[model samples]
Target: MNEITVSLPDGSKRSLAAGATILDLAASIGTGLAKAAIAGKVDGNLVDLQTPLADGATVEIVTEKSPDALHIIRHSTSHLMAQAVKQLFPQAKVTIGPAIETGFYYDFDLEKSFSPEDLEKIEAKMRELAKADLKIEREVLSSADAIELFRTMGEDYKVELIQDLGAESVSLYRQGDFVDLCRGPHLPRTSLCKAFKLTSLAGAYWRGDEKRAMLQRVYGTAFADKKELEAYLARIEEAKKRDHRKLGRELDLFSFNDEVGAGLVIWHPKGAMLRTILEDFERREHLKRGYDIVLGPQILKTELWQRSGHYENYRENMYFTTIDEQGYGIKPMNCLSHMMIYKSQLRSYRDLPLRFFELGTVHRHERAGVLHGLLRVRGFTQDDAHILCTPDQLDAEIKGVLSFVRDVMGIFGFDYEMELSTRPEKSIGSDEDWERATSALLSALKDSGREFEINEGDGAFYGPKIDIKLRDALDRRWQCATIQCDFTLPERFELTYVDADGEKKRPVMVHRVILGAIERFIGVLIEHFAGNFPTWLAPVQATIVTVTDNQIPYAETAFNTLRAAGVRVQKDFRNEKLGFKIREAQLQKIPYMLVVGDKEVEAGLVAPRFRDGKNLESMTPEQFIAFIQDEVKSYR
Candidate 1:
């Protein structure tokens, strides 16, 4: 046999017999490496260990410790799950399964819905298959042959998918009697799929189209080891306990009614108060940052949306109506009105950077299936702002917004990541404008010295943007802030300012939101804090619990004094026992409870007890009011 030379990741070369596979190369290095090898990377592309290494090809042996290991393991585990499902329910047909960010999911079309008991059986079967350690092999066949093979197996979905692929050849992976159509690079054997668990089941439309057949989606996750899997499961349990919807109901914050409609939030008193506090904070922050408070009409002429490219690019998400023979669009974005405001005035270069801020309420037609409690609602308010600045000033404006995001996230004790999304295929604007806008955002992000990833082809239709995703207590990412740079929209609306040379020049617009949506942020906060809001943010900061009927008069006096002094205080004077009232208040997550008894009345003081069972020293009403004020100011 002829000798072949292959390049290792460390830039070293190894001579082996021609047609040597990646597994053979691993063995050549060391026996331990061969045993640890689960897959291989050939010239940066993941491949099976059986893949032949071409002469002089760059290769890296993938072990369980590699970053790509989990994805490959999860993908293979999905196949393991599919094989189990097929063995248990031969009537069920498989469609597609792919590894997602958190885990993997496989979709199945069956006449019966999957129950929890069925999941257990399927999982048990998967364990059995894994224990058998069946050798998994990949095979390529002509598209026509692939379709015929799936058709014989009664997999209509697979056949349809293969036909739609319109390819000359297709690859399929087979383990035992079970086979699935997929791209290359899976585990060599079934037993490698050890640390896996089927998390949940959901109903998903085939290909995400509501008109198509609904399929059962089995969600599962796989880790490199059992310890990591256990940790993930523990986090998931904690997440369930901290779910915002459950906390909302328990804390009497918000609700959604069928009578009102889907994706619309009905805020209760406490929820409304929380929202108001957040909005007030946004206003003060914006004002301090030199933003001019502004408001726009809820509905605008549809022609304006068309002129702004929204009607052409985003019409599906917009609501339209005819008012007095004039077509109108309920504003789904606040950019158009801000543009109108810019064009409303004649300006010089001195007035170049006009920052207009609005706590704008907008409506979008969100699909019912995607809407969650308050996170993905149709009707919501945004802390939206637009900064119209000269081209030279664009970088500063964007960095300012980045600084604003950093400060706000720090205040909330949240760690966040940023992604720079570039132009999408369906976006509007000239290539030159798109490049300029993308470059501006990129420059600002780089100058800020913060690491960010480039998310390709996910930008808004008009321009590129920086998306800020904040990590919560469970390390889950939520889309909270965004900064979008647009050179096209100002040109579309013909917004111009006089330059130093007295020539009218088009100004660039930076549309940004520090906290993307008020409702979503509040939901994130509820989950982040687990409904135990800090003293400053608690809707009812303090409550007065009278020791007995004799103390009601004193409790009422204390409550009125606190209320007058600007404390969010409530009184529990229903003639209840002190401990009972204290327990109820604690359940409500009130920050402080002031107990009024005969002794308290005599001393003209209140016994303050913290929700965590710590007792503050007795203080007069005036002194307590000052303490609360000081605590609130500390958050600021």
Candidate 2:
């Protein structure tokens, strides 16, 4: 037999038959590996265990420990589901099945509508197929032969897909009696898919085109280990309990009225109070940092946006209106408005970096399917700002923004990960300009000593950008801070300043938002702290519960004093048991509960209890006030 050298993960080489499969290599190594092997990586591309080896090639057997093996398993599970569908509904035409973020989905076009009963039947068939432990086999054929096979098999979607294949051959996989048109790196046998569950079913347009066939898509999730699968299901249950939409209703935070609009969120009293507190804290911080607050209009002439290039690229997301027979658009970004402000005045090198800030509410029309609570809503307020400066001033401006982002995130006790997104394929500006902007962004992140990954070809059309993701209490990451560099917007809008050289040059624009959207950030805050906001930020911070009617007078006095001190105090003087009143306050997650009884009243003292059930000894009312004040001050 012809022999070939296979490179192993340990930097060692092994000689084997040139046409050998990955299973053969694993068997040579040990039974343990052969049993554990799920697939193979040949020259870095995932493939089946039966692939013929290339001479002097790299090979690594993928096992449960391999990171990408989960995706391989999910892909295979999707195929298995499709196979089950085909087995049950022989007339069901399979289209495409792909691995998703946390699951897999397969689309099928069937004459009859599928119901919950059908899902149960499909799942039972899947388990039956899994128990068979049938070997998964692969076949490669010429393009013409593959097309003919799909055509003969009555898979029109597969035939349509094969027409686009410019390659000489295509691969197909089969297990038991069900064969599929796929390029798979599937498990060796059906038994390897130990745990999986069908999640849901939805209607999707073929290729997302409504004109095409409406396909029924079945979604499912798979895992390598059963314990992890159970844990994931448990987390999903916990997430459902903590969902902001449901929590918002239970907490009376906000509401969306269909009569008003789809994406417009109306903050209720409690929510508005929270917003005010958050905004107040941010305003004070900005003022101390020498940031100049400015205002901009909600509507601008379409000509202005055209100059800013928003009309060309982002117009689809913008809301356009006609006024005075001229087209106008509701702003989707604050950068354009700030740019117009900078252009309104002349500046010299002495005024190098000008930071103009706004809590701008902007409108962007999003698809109906993508909206989820406040997290993905349209028409939201952004804590947005723009800095116009020269290349010499870029570093300091970046440092300032970084420091602000860090301080803000730090306030919430948020730990963050960073990503630097570079230019996209269809972006504006010269190649040289794009390179410089990307370099500036990367340098800022490096200088700050922040670890970041590069997201290639994911930047905004005008410039490269830096994005910050904060891991919440659930360990779920949410992208909240964005720092972008824009050269094209300034040039397009003819925004410039005079340098020491006495010549006019376009100023570079830096758009940054520390807290992306007030609504989304507030929603995140709800989940992060489980609705127990910090003392200063809480809508109702302290509740004074009286032990009896005699103590009610003292509670009222104490509440009055606390309110005058701006402590967010409330009086709970209802004729009820002290324990019941305390329980009510705790349920609301109020940061503090002050208990007043006749003995404490006579002693001019009170008992302090933190919302988390920590207690303090009886203290003078004056001491209690001082302690709560100190806690609030420390929060700032």
Candidate 3:
């Protein structure tokens, strides 16, 4: 046998026969690693532990403790689900099953939807197969042979997949009576997946083509330990309880009208009030950050979007129309108009970093299925801004943007992850343009000491981007901030500034948003606080609840005084009991409730009760107003 040299992360090497498997290498090291091993990363490619090695290669066994091991467990758990489904519902055809951020899902085309009962039965079978501990075997075969096998098994979707694979040979994973076409580094046995759960089911098209058959996708998540699994499930439960859609209706913050169509939100009066406060807050913050406020028309000629590249690469999401034989589009983005504003006059290098900010509302036609209230909407306002600067100013500008993003997210109490999305397969711009833009983004991120991951081939056709994933209070992440570097637009629009030498140089364009949307941010805020907004941003910061009819006059007086003091106080003067009023106020999550009963009124005092139902000692109306103002000031 030919000798092979295998290297480990610790700079250790072992000589072995050329066909040595990860399991063989691990045994050569110790039984402890071999048992803990789930897969191996061979020269940057993840492969099964049983995979044979070539003459010379770098190898590292992926144990349960490795960062990538959990994903492997989840992916293999997805295969176990397929095996369980096949054993119970043989007619279902599997298409794709991949591990997602927090879970795994398998899409299948079947005659009927799998109900809760069906899931229970399938889960029982899954446990049985897991107990059996069937070894997962890998096989490589020609695409033609794979197509024939799936065809014979009546898996038309799998057969269709083989045709589109565009590969001569495809790897297949088989365990027990189930077989799946996959490029896998799955767990060696069904028992290796220590903990698993079937999460939810949804409808998805075969290949994201709405015209194709809708497949039933069963989502699941797996973890190495039972406690971790339970923790995940608990987090999911908390997230569901905090879902913005439910809170929006329960708190009467916002609604969607069928006549208004999907993806367009109708902010009720209370919602609007909350939004106004947030917008005002953002405006003040932007002014403090030296951003020049700007605005543009909601609709513009098609020629503008064409120059912006929105009509070319993102036309599907844009709404189009015509005015007097000239094509126009509902502005899907604000960058183009910002550019035209810049090009209106020649700019000197002294005005190098011109930052223009806008609370711009734009419309895009999102798919119907993906629409979920403010989170995923068509017509929404973005706290959008554009920065046009010289190449020398790139690093400082991005760092400034990052600081701005951090401040906005801090106001919302959001923790976030950063991602640098590099060039896509189909993109414009010269190699130098791409290189410079990419370097500037990375430089800024490193300078800020922010740790970020890369998303390859997910950038805009025009340039690379920095995406911020803000995690809510429930620890659920949402992509709410983005900084994109665009080179194509500047070139297309011929946008340039005069340098110190009086030479015309194209300015680098940056698109950024801190709080992505006022509407969506409101939704997020609703969930983050469970509809209990900070006193400053609350629609009704404090409510004056009268104890009886006689106290109405006193309550009204107190309300008038607070309103004069600029407090959002509501007069709940109904003839209900004091306890009843307190309960109502608590349900509304009002920050403060000032109860004016007979004693308090006669004493010229108001008994304060926090919305949390914690009763504070009775105090003079003057003292009560002062206390509320302090709370609002602190934004607690």
Q: Pick the candidate with the highest TM-score.
A: 1
lDDT of 1 by residue, 200-281 (tens): 9998999999999999999999998899999999999999999999999999999999999998999999999998988998
Minimum summed lDDT over a 10-residue window in model 2 is located at 620-629
Query: Per-prediction TM-score, please?
Result: 0.99, 0.92, 0.96
Error of 1 at 329 (Å): 1.0
- State which candidate, 2 or 3, has the greater TM-score: 3
Q: What is candidate 3's lDDT per residue for 1-636, written digit by digit as tens?
A: 688888888888899987889999998899999888899999889999899987668899999889999999999999999989988888888889999998899998899889988878877887888899999999999999999999999989888888987899999999988999999989999998778889888999989999999999999899998999999999889878878898888777889998989888988887888888888887899889888999999999998887767787889999999889999999888988899899999899999899999999999999999998888899999999999999888888899989988877776688899999999987778888998999999989988887999999898888999999988887777788899987778998999999999899999999999988777777788888888878888898888888789988888888888888888888899988888888888888888898888898889988888888788999887887788788766752
Candidate 3 residue spans exceeding 4 A from truth: none
Error of 1 at 547 (Å): 1.3
Residue 366 in candidate 3, Cα distance off native in Å: 0.7
Q: What is the C-alpha lDDT of each candidate?
A: 0.93, 0.87, 0.88
Could you list the CA RMSD of all candidates, in the order they appear?
Answer: 1.1, 2.6, 1.7
Scored against the true structure, residue 253 in model 2 reaches a CA lDDT of 81
How many Å off is the CA of 274 in candidate 3?
A: 1.2
Clashing pairs in 1: none
